[model samples]
Target: GAERQVRLPLGCHHPLVPLHLHEERPSYVVCGGAVFTALSQPYLQHEWGKAWERRAPVSLVAKALNGSKAQRGEQVVLLSQLLGHECVRGYDSALLANSMVRALNGVPILCLAQLAQLVLACRQRSLRFDLEESRVLVLDTAQARGAEAEILQQHNIPEPVLINERDAALLR
Candidate 1:
């Protein structure tokens, strides 16, 4: 399968990346099997993945919200490689959109779950999140997974980081 990716206007300086040097050569994805199979892998510390511990799913969701419209060539490489311990991975479109929206506005991210609901609500009720190079986001469209859908249906919900059980359960 061709994994879809939207490159943000950051982190294009992969010196040894062959495809970058020779555009004639097609780029191949470094497959991350079982997404969390090697979550303990080593990585250099940087600002890239600071949210894994600090904001987690919420931060990621916000990123996705902001990433929807990034240009074709620009992309943000995952800052840290010690990756894949949660449902919200670097390529998760829904989570990235959520995070991107939050980061762009400098707003307090109260809840990932509720935000996910809001993400869907915006689509249903005509709210829009700003993002680019859209990832295959399911938070709004995957209604077969009833849990998130129900959350969207609720009223007077509080803000909180989320791990949509229905969505998470499907990934597991």
Candidate 2:
């Protein structure tokens, strides 16, 4: 991946941001249940989502990025910019475990593909996905059997990505 500049529109409130190459975690969430810590950051995030949002669903995620046309669905994918857990702002909270606490009940990650969809959506709406870190994404593994990044402002948690260490080992 190459380095580039991106500008944020709504929640970020930033003009532009610099993105680095290979700076993101490689973890992912799995399609079935259970979390595997040995995986990379992107993989972990993907796997967790799949387990949590399979068939019968729960809540959703919505992204109002500058250039994205917001997606409307009970089951939508999260964007890369909106990936990291939110930061706590209380005076004491900042110094304490507030950051962790705020994330105690939030989606904390996504993938490159999810970020792409977000970028497309923003581009469609004339917004920017300026250098977002810790992004979230939705994977339609059931249909495509592959990961696809989607930045839905009004979407539920995405189905977790499948983690098959045996197959991954083969690929490596």
Candidate 3:
């Protein structure tokens, strides 16, 4: 008798990644036992859809309103990453699409649970964290103690340095 093998589907990097690379290597995807390349990015829009797809934005708003400070910070990080912006302010400024801002009422906290869900999805599907390749800002000390710090260390991403409180105040 022959043994049957099970293969899992892994997610791919953002569609734009190929344009920036020197070589056109496929995005990193890890199947159960083996890894493979996807011919093209899979479900790019789904990354955005996780928050506003089938559900009501009001629910997200309630979640953020009731969530903790850490949750708010996480939401800001995820939104900034998604928009390819280093900071939440930048995302707000550059994002001309009013729908997203309107959906969350421009409250960054409302994006928390969606961000968490997206992160989990990426892990389960073995998707590459392309958003993280961009510059990241570590504002408060809390970020230094969480997974964000671990990711920065793992990627060798340098944290932005503030020489003094004055400089730190400018970031705020």
Q: What TM-score do all the candidates reach, one by one?
A: 0.20, 0.16, 0.17
Which one wins by TM-score: 1 or 2?
1
Candidate 3 on 6-69: residue-level lDDT in tens? Answer: 8999963322111122333323211111111211112222323544324423433333334333
Q: What are the lDDT figures for the candidates, one per model? A: 0.27, 0.25, 0.27
lDDT of 2 by residue, 1-172 (tens): 9999999776633211112114534323322111111222233235355442342112221121122322211111222122222211111311221011111113221332332233323322122222123322222323212222332121333543432342233223
Candidate 1's C-alpha runs over 4 A off are 1-99, 102-117, 120-130, 133-145, 148-172
Sliding window of 10 residues with minimal summed lDDT for model 2: 96-105
lDDT of 1 by residue, 1-172 (tens): 8999987786643211111222221111111111110011011112236343354443333443343324332222221221232222445433442223221122222222333334433434222233334323222223323333233234222321234342223223
Which residue pairs in candidate 3 collide? none
* Ranking of candidates on lDDT, top first: 1, 3, 2
